[model samples]
Target: MGIIKLTNIRVYAYHGCLVEEGKIGSDYRVDVSVKANLQPSAGTDNLKDTVDYVHINRIVKEEMAIRSKLLEHVSKRILDRIFNEIPIAEEATVEVSKINPPIGGNVEMVTIEMTLHRHNHKQQSEL
Candidate 1:
């Protein structure tokens, strides 16, 4: 199986459990990985054999706007949304990180990283 990786996708939004965090928001970076067979794309030089990035961006933007109390839930929502929407993808993983969160400390950033895997018949998207 071949894999396509998308990294360092950035978004600024209101996503956090803290009151000020939600009100002010912050910068978030997301990384995603997709696993699927790339035989046709590799052989024919056609885009249809691979996943589309525009669709992925749309899903990420839509999900991030929904708001969440925790980064973990937001991360899960991203993974699930792509899995449910994209047909050719077999597995997906999402990692979300917040830079300079409103923690009032010297810490660089707080991160919520998760890797989710799905088989052909298993569909779990209810966020």
Candidate 2:
């Protein structure tokens, strides 16, 4: 098994609980860790044999572009999209961080992380 980690992917997107947040937008950071079998790709050095992180990153970017009301929703969407796109991934950990969240205090960021296993995800899809 091999892990593909994409960290601190910065994106400017409109996502928040408040109306102003969606209007002005804020910076967000996404981190994704994908676990998969790398034996085939390792031996063949073929892109198709492993998870294409470039495409994964692109999917993240595209999903981030869509405005959402909550971080949890966005994070789940990302995980779902990743699982749908990368069938070979055995498990995925996704984190979505909202930079400097709009609270009445000083906060660096508010983050939500979720992990999904392919088998369970597949079962969910089947139902």
Best model number under TM-score: 2
Which lDDT tens digits does candidate 1 get at residues 8-124? Answer: 888888988788877888888887888878887889888877777777887777777877989898888888777777777888878788888777798777888887777632644
Report lDDT per candidate: 0.80, 0.92
Q: What does candidate 2's lDDT look like per residue over 54-73, in tens digits?
A: 98899899999999998888
| Model 1 stretches with alpha carbons more than 4 Å out | 120-127
Worst 10 residues of 1 by lDDT: 118-127
